[model samples]
Target: MTERILDHPVLGALEPDQTVTFTFNGMTYEGRDGEPIAAALLAAGVRTLRHHEESGTPRGIYCNIGHCFECRVEVDGQQGVRACLTPVREGMVINGGGPLPAPVRDWRKNHA
Candidate 1:
């Protein structure tokens, strides 16, 4: 996949950040170091982070301040992590476009 470029009229050509490789939904992608996973995914043109378990509805980043769980994704073997809150790390494995288990929803309800 090609790396995304954002050219802002006011910002002009901004210096690129250091990038790290991470996998999203079995496909490899690059993300900037120390940035939010959602930001990285958005930059990479990933619009659907996960699907609703029951309705199979697509969901992506919303209420970026971490108030919403719309950006939940699976990292490594762990599930239901908020992409908006989690920083992208080198070699991180992100699994998107899947259903959240019941335990994940229960945990989010109590903790999020």
Candidate 2:
């Protein structure tokens, strides 16, 4: 089942929007153009956008707003783009966020 609310008691039936295809983790999926990436991904049954850098815990949409960074994902070669705020564009190359890079021998201490 899709996550969209097609027939709302207050809004009635909703018309289908233009569908756009985008790549997420090398897989193509359809979504409404200009809709939030998080919404589209959720509709596609993608609950885990990324895993926690340190804990390896799965992470997905939390606040559904632009404030939280939990829904961050890579888009068009950029990292840490908020999926909840970023609009889904056709043919966009998106890679789900991954674990943070391990510190290289604690360079901060050496540099200090």
Candidate 3:
């Protein structure tokens, strides 16, 4: 992936924001504070978020308004988290659609 620094025509001289470090697929990446996860990933040249669970098809940020679940990712210990709606935070651990935590069964299948 190529470097994706934005050079906007209308918003000349983009100001740098407070940066926060977040891990994506075990790799550290820098993102602006309060920025959406998808925007941060796109700026870093990361197009694919995860592969379809059934077909293994690559999925990326689509309908960035949080209408579509194409940008779902695993964050910390949570599964099926929507990246487009989530803000970038310091020390966030992100996974590239890896295996999710097993579903809760019988309300206490494993807890009991």
Candidate 4:
């Protein structure tokens, strides 16, 4: 993939690892198996992992590590999963865009 790093300075020459097919938002994509879900998603040109629950702002991989919760996604019907810490697996179903919170909409509507 064009998004993937073919070579790294410290990591040496990058070689193709086992590829796994996973679905994101109902679209199928291929990624290196066992890599962080965040990396796989990015390599597959997926930037916005999910939207903020309250604000509805687009969220993505900010830290690339597990510290930041920006990369939250739904994995296998589970919500609030951190993609950066989770490994890519075969046939995994990931939902990057979930239903927006109704409270925000209701609050805005009522206030307006």
Evaluate all candidate structures by whole-model CA lDDT and list the values in order.
0.85, 0.87, 0.82, 0.87
Ordered list by TM-score, greatest first:
2, 4, 3, 1
* Model 1 C-alpha lDDT per residue in residues 1-112, reported as the tens digit of each score: 5345667688777578898999999888898888899988998888899998745689998899898898888898788899999999999999875655878777877896
Report the lDDT of model 2 for residue 111.
73
Candidate 1 regions with alpha-carbon error over 4 angstroms: 1-13, 100-112
1-112: candidate 2 lDDT, tens digit per residue? 4788879999999788899999999999889999999999999999999887655689999999888899989999999999999999999998876655567335543676
Counting only residues 3 or more apart in sequence or on different chains, how many pairs clash (N, Cα, C under 3 Å) in candidate 3?
A: 0
Q: How close is every model to the real structure, measured as TM-score?
A: 0.77, 0.86, 0.79, 0.84
In candidate 2, position 91 carries an lDDT of 94
Best of the two (3, 4) by lDDT: 4
RMSD of each candidate?
4.9, 2.8, 5.8, 2.8
Model 2, residue pairs in steric clash: none
User: What 10-residue stretch in candidate 4 is worst by lDDT?
Assistant: 96-105
Each candidate structure's count of clashing pairs: 0, 0, 0, 0
Regions more than 4 Å wrong, model 2:
102-112
Better of 2 and 3 by TM-score: 2
Global fold similarity of model 2 (TM-score): 0.86
